[model samples]
Target: MNKLFFSAVIGMTLFLGGCMLAPEYDRPEAPVPSELPSGAAYDGSSSSSEVPLVADLKWREFFPDPKLQQVIATALDNNRDLRLAVLNVERARALYGIQRAELFPAVTATGGGSKQRSSADLTESGYPRTTEQYNANLGVASWEIDFFGRIRSLKEQALQEYLATEEARRSAQIALVAEVARVYLTLAADRENLQLAQSTLETQLGSHDLIRLQYDEGVATELDLRRSQTQVDTASRNIAIYTQQVAQDQNALNLLAGSLVPDELLPVDFASVIPPKELSPGLSSETLLNRPDILAAENRLKGSYAYIGAARAAFFPRISLTAAIGTASDELSGLFSSGSDTWSFAPQIGMPIFDSRTWAAYRVSKATREIALAQYEKTIQTAFREVADALAVRGTVDQQIAAQQSIVDSAQTIYDLSNELFTQGVSGYFGVLDAHRTLYAAQQGLTYLQLARRANQVRLYAVLGGGGNLEVAEADFTN
Candidate 1:
């Protein structure tokens, strides 16, 4: 009987190690165009081999501004959202480790001692009697022998989930970097607007004082004085509005950074904040596959397939083992003595008979797989649209900035001509007032256009999956 049992154990080991019931996995086709769209909106912006792809570039290299880089680094270190993502990755990794340990038997050790007294009626001698016993054992208890790959499938699923969580952490960091840059640029632009408002207020105040002086001397009309007052009031109102916007932008930056931003790192004006380096979308839309969010979605899809494998394996027979080798003795010191050895082996096999829940579980796994497939496709589609939109903006922003600059120049010239004519009595003061209004509007428009141009660069970098190449190890939060 002992020899037969040993042989059966060896045979089961070999057989169980060789079988896997999980279905084969095939990656679904991407649901997007092979190439990006091209036309007037995307002219001259098509990907070229010579152009540098955002994927190869680091965040520091893409954003050359020292202050902005410092701010982004601070955010990476302190942002609560990013910290949570890192923690999730750690959690998933730990779960994967737990699932993997089930592939092998868990051996345990146990020891016990007991003393019991027998009643007088139970003793043959009609007297009370006492007995002592001791035992020690090393054994495996009901360890499931994975004959149909169920444990293996579960392990695979856990591994994929862990990978998916790691990708999510990368995605969070990438988003944080982009958000910091966006808010930084916006703060700079608002500062510039405030300065412009202040300068216009100074100019309008001078014009208002001159018109008041002339009206007091009976040389300027009441209408002219009132018009000057209106210009001054308009400039004053803008100053107040822009001042509030700048404060709000600063608050936003602080929230993203998760701490107070240093004064030295703040942008003084739009022109002072250097433009970020340019990036290319590459010729093929396949680049989107490398994006962190898309990769995360794919990992989830693979995990769902692994779940289906586990579900399928549940239909097969389950084998378990319970075995022990130990020594027992009536005397306390003789527990490990010669001739005291004892052992036990128990193997069990259970076949599924009549449970409706098993079939329902299989159906649920199939439904999960389909859902994952659709989500994977949707992620790819969303990534494609983002890149295309950024490219379209890239194609036309420069022209818009150039046109706005020209308008400022023309308006400045008109304002100068009108002022000269009014002083010489060749034109009315209303022409001068209209020219001032036109020039001020043109200048403000130019500032906004420049801001848009710079913001587009940041957007393109983000959409193309730049800024995720930074290496990050599992964070230690024990402290």
Candidate 2:
């Protein structure tokens, strides 16, 4: 009889394990264009024909500056936001484990003792009497048998949620790297601007002194001296502004790094900063599908699909089994003696026949899944836009930089000629002041343009989902 019962139990387990009521999942169609937009914005030459995908480049390789790489590594290690993302992935994993455990029985061991006394009038012997009983048992409490796959569906949902959190953590790490690099580049540019301003101020001061001397000798007017001093003052003001900005930029970089950056790791100036070479953005928009944020969105959509499955399973009968096998006797010593053995088997089946809430939940799950689907599509669209914008900037930034450099060169020539002409008494000091101001403005604009060009490369690297080496396991951060 025991063999027959065991065989039946094994057969039931196999049958129920194969049963699933959840609808099959299908990936939604891509909502964006099949090809990336092309025009002047995307006309840049591809990096190298033999080079791998931009995403395959390691962060260290993409950022060749040893100091910049160190800063990025430090930011990844210390950023609070990225740390929180890692912790969330752990939390989701634990939640998934809890849900997955529901498919199995939970057995417990229990023991207890009781003593009772009966009234003399009610006793068969017409005398007061006390009885003692002791019992011990190993039991399984209301473990659900997932015949309709509700437990499986819930487990699937939990699994997808865990995956989504993992992807979110990856996204955070990528953003952190990009942000650190951009801020570091900004600091470099600001330092260069500060130096430029100071140099211009010194030159203007000399010019101011020369004009004052000429005016004293009756060869220059009061206006020429005043205008030269104004140029000096303007340059000094620029120096002050850039100094403040450089300090602020340092503070911002420290905030992202989660600690004060060491001076050794900071760029000395824009000259020391090396911009990354142009990266090929790959041949198609399909690359955006691999982006971490988009992957996270898709996982969320998958989780919603699992939720709908669980809701649909709610309409089916739920079966639970509670069983105990142990011993009961009048005395503690006799609890395990011959003929003291005891066993119980209770199976329950519940179906929601009158409750309207279950149906409502099913509707809610379906609607939620629809919402997730839309959100997934939106994420893809957003990623596509970012890539397109970065490519557009990349295509024109070189030309922009070249043209700006030309303007600076012309302005420098004009300034030199104006200074010589004034010293020769052939032109007024106004020409010298105008040329100097124009040259200064052009130099500042060139500095900003260089920063922009470098920043665009960083953006493209980030939007392309960063390097393959960045795909780290959760254990990497936790340790």
Candidate 3:
């Protein structure tokens, strides 16, 4: 008899295990072009034969700077925002475990003793009497059998949510790497500008002193002396401005790193740093679908679909089972004696007949699933736009940098010629002052352009989701 009952239980478990009500999932079509947009702004080579996909490239290999690699590593290890993202993944995992536990019955062991006094009028002995009882049992409490797959659907939703959280953590890590690299590059450029300003100020001060001596001997006019003094003041003011900018950039870099950054890791000059090698963004835009954010969105959509399955199951009858087997006696010593055994087996069936809430919930779940589908498509579109914008900048930035460099070189030549002409009385000091001003502005502009070019490369790598193998491990928040 026991073997027949055990076989029946096993058969039922197997039958219910295969009953999933959720619709089969298929990935939606990507909402982007078949290939990257082509024009003068995207004139770069797209030869897949020569270049590896950006997503396959490790960040350390892309950056190639020891200090920058170290800074990125530190940010991955300690950045507060990234840490929070990792913690959220853990929270989701635990929630999924909780939902998974619902598939199994909760067994509990219970033991108790009770004593009661009976009134003389009610007692057959016609005197006040006391009754004592002791009991011990093992029982299962309201375990839903999941005949309609309601519990299974909810468990699937939780699993997808956990997966979405994991992808979100990866997205945060990639962004952190890109932001740290960009801020470090900015700091390096500002420091270079500060040094340039100091050098220019020193040269201007020497010119001012020379003009003052010439004026005292009536060889130079007061106008020339005042022009040189003005140049000196301008250079000094620029030095102060660059100094402030450098300090602010350092603070920004430190914030991204989530701690104080050591001076040794800071770049000395923008020119000394080697920018990341240009990546060959493939003609096909399908690779953007592999981005962590895109994957997270799709998982969220799947979770919403699972929720719809669970809501639909709510309209079906729910079956629950409760059972207990134990012994009871008037004395604790006799609780397990022969003839004292007691047992119970109770199964419950509940069908929603008059409940309007179940149908309302089903509608809400379907609406939520539609919203998730829209969001998933939107994520893909945003990613495509970001990659296109970065590639557009990437295609033209090198030429822009080269043109700015030429402007700086020509300005220097003109300034040198004007100074020689002024000393020989062939040109006025006003001509020399104008050339000096133009050269200073050109040099500053060139520095900023170089910084932008380098920063753009980092941005492109990030949008392409290129930092997955960056040697930074996921944070261990168990501590």
C-alpha lDDT (0 to 100) for residue 420 of candidate 3: 91
Write model 1 residue lDDT over 74-148, tens digit each, in one string. Answer: 999999999999999999989988898898899999999999999999999999999999999999999998878
What ranges in model 1 sit over 4 Å off? 48-50, 467-479
Q: Candidate 2, residues 199-293: lDDT per residue as tens digits?
A: 99889888888889999999999998889889988998999999999999999999999999999998889989877756787877888888888
Give, for candidate 1, the lowest lDDT window spanning 10 residues: 470-479
Error of 3 at 86 (Å): 0.8
Give candidate 3's TM-score.
0.93
Pairs that collide, model 1: none
State model 2's lDDT: 0.87
The best-first sequence of candidates by TM-score reads 1, 2, 3
Which of the two candidates, 1 or 3, achieves a greater lDDT against the reference? 1
What TM-score fits each model?
0.95, 0.95, 0.93
Cα RMSD (angstroms) for every candidate in the order listed: 3.1, 3.0, 3.5
Off by over 4 Å in 3: 1-16, 469-479
Candidate lDDT scores, in order, read 0.87, 0.87, 0.86
